[model samples]
Target: MKRIEPLSAARRGVPRWLRRALGPVLLIALWHLVSITGVLPQEVLAGPSVVLTSAAKLVATGELQQAMWVSLGRALAGLAIGGTIGVSLAVLSGLSRLGEDLIDATVQMLRTVPNVALIPLLIIWLGIGEAPKIALIALGTAFPLYLNVYAGIRNVDASLIEAGRTLNLSRSAMIRHIILPGALPSALVGLRYSLGIAWLALVFGEQINATAGIGYLMANAREFFQTDVIVVCLAVYAFLGLAVDFIVRTLERIFLSWRPAFSGT
Candidate 1:
């Protein structure tokens, strides 16, 4: 008789995307189970069903849609400003010792201070309008990208530089062909990190005496003890983060197609 394989040893037939989705599915199931069983009180944490209902109500009222648009606009604006500053500084500092000496020290010092802590100063400087909020998001995102891109540039293989030298490639050509491509992977990683931080910054930024956004919804919910609404807002933040992350991952797959790396099958 043929020996039977254990279940764990059986070849997996599940699609990769389905497998990836299983984790969230299982967690939601467990959450729903605990919620209905009263393992956690609704006051402490609302059930997924309640949260879903709350989300639906917000959607029907168009409140959620408006808030989402506002939040997305702020996050995108901040990202654009921050990404430009981060990449420009990284390229400058990474390419030349003099530039590094001038900029890196200041960046290193500033990054150690929490971006949120600057809210008071930022409010004083830029006022309670959108300026402070956008500036805060930009501040939070810049450091991660700068660090990664700078490292990527500095870490390009010495042999590649030697090869470029042998080819008599000019400074600009060498950077364009060898250095920048080598740094692309790291820069992509920085982008992913920056995107995550941008959402986080948005969370804090929106809470600053704001009249709109998901954070504003949560803040209002807090005053009324509307746990379900708060939970819905929290879920919105999570979903937004996941959506942006998916976009970045898609970009990576497209840009890094030439780079061979082991897929953890």
Candidate 2:
């Protein structure tokens, strides 16, 4: 059996920053070495230097910023729509047996259906507009939130619930005071874990008859064999994901200050 460490008592070293940075610094050095040694064809896999120059060009022309804004807007729009619906339905499902049985099976079935597989049908129905793209990201984001919230609500300790009941708390009062607070951490985790999938769904969604966006830029570059542009687009993807995840982690730290385990345990 795999051993599990108890996070409640575990703590990381204060100077862990250096250790954390070492892996990425080594990876970058290795990449530079491989490029210099001609381990890979330059035309297919351009050097980091070329990618940096292409990125500079894009930034100078404001193309990078424009594409970044469009992608971010789409992702946030979808997030708003999906997060609202997920939390609402999750609360309903957890509160009532009828709601749980009705929505749970349908959600499972939809989740099993690959989001990419819906692209063609979405393009046909929504016509490659913002509607289709937003819909795709929403679909990708919803299930995770639903699963996390439902699990979180269901797992709240019975003792705490009984205490609330003994205090003569109303059903709504218990949910608001005890259940939601208990479930908030897991729901936040779901949101944090979802940043990558939301970004990916936006990329794929933009691919359908796309006119603008970094994904479009990257795909168009592939046609002319511009590996540097492809690399730059991918770098943007990496940077954007990193920036968003950092923000989420910071938010988690602020809201979950009571949870010592999340503080590098």
Candidate 3:
């Protein structure tokens, strides 16, 4: 006869989404408690309610929407430009020994230097305008995608290459049909990383003579000690990051539907 399982051994009844939400909920509750008790002063950091109100005000005044659009444009432009350069260089370096010898070492050296450290030089070269900001973001985003794409190309299954060889596939056909598909998952991961880096780079870039954008708003708020407004800008940044991450996840699901792995149940 089968034995009954103990209650302690049963799976959780909580929904997956609810379980995920619980942690943030608990944190917010604890924060509210401390805030109401005056353990956390508003001068240092505004409480959640104040931050929410500030966000609403910004939204109503249309300032937040205008700022968001400007920031989004910069981030997307940088991502597009950087992604193209990264993919081209990765393809070159990964495919030919001569290309690797010429390009890889130089890229590796440059990658060692922090992108943020180049801000002053970028400003000197490109000026304290949108040009410098977009260039900085592009520079910051390129390396991650380049590295991942190169690795992915080099790591494509040898057996698959042999199979293509047996089929007498042309070089172009082999790359188009076999190598690119094999490398795509890694490229997607790199894209995700690059997207994150783009946002970070934008934050730094916007701090330099920016007339608009979330970074500008935050900087302006700091002058008046508007902690609530600062927090609102921070939250906007976070929400945008999360939104882009979710988009990437959706792309992975669409493109990698054939690949399967253990889901940590």
TM-scores, in order shown?
0.94, 0.91, 0.94
Q: Sort the candidates on lDDT, descending order.
A: 1, 3, 2
Better of 1 and 2 by TM-score: 1
TM-score of 2: 0.91
Q: Which portions of model 1 show Cα errors greater than 4 Å?
A: 1-10
Judged by TM-score relative to the true structure, which candidate is superior, 2 or 3? 3
- In model 2, the Cα lDDT at residue 238 comes to 83
Cα lDDT, model 1, residue 19: 87
* lDDT, each prediction: 0.93, 0.85, 0.92
Per-residue alpha-carbon lDDT of candidate 3 for residues 170-238, written as tens digits (9 for 90 to 100): 999999999999999999999999999999998998999999999999899999999999988887888
In terms of lDDT, model 2 sits at 0.85
lDDT of 2 at 41: 71
Every model: Cα RMSD to truth: 4.1, 5.1, 3.4
Model 1 lDDT per residue over 113-151, tens place: 999899999999999999999999999889999999999
Error of 1 at 245 (Å): 1.0
- Candidate 3 wrongly placed segments (more than 4 Å): 1-12
Task: Count residue pairs with overlapping backbones in model 2.
Answer: 0
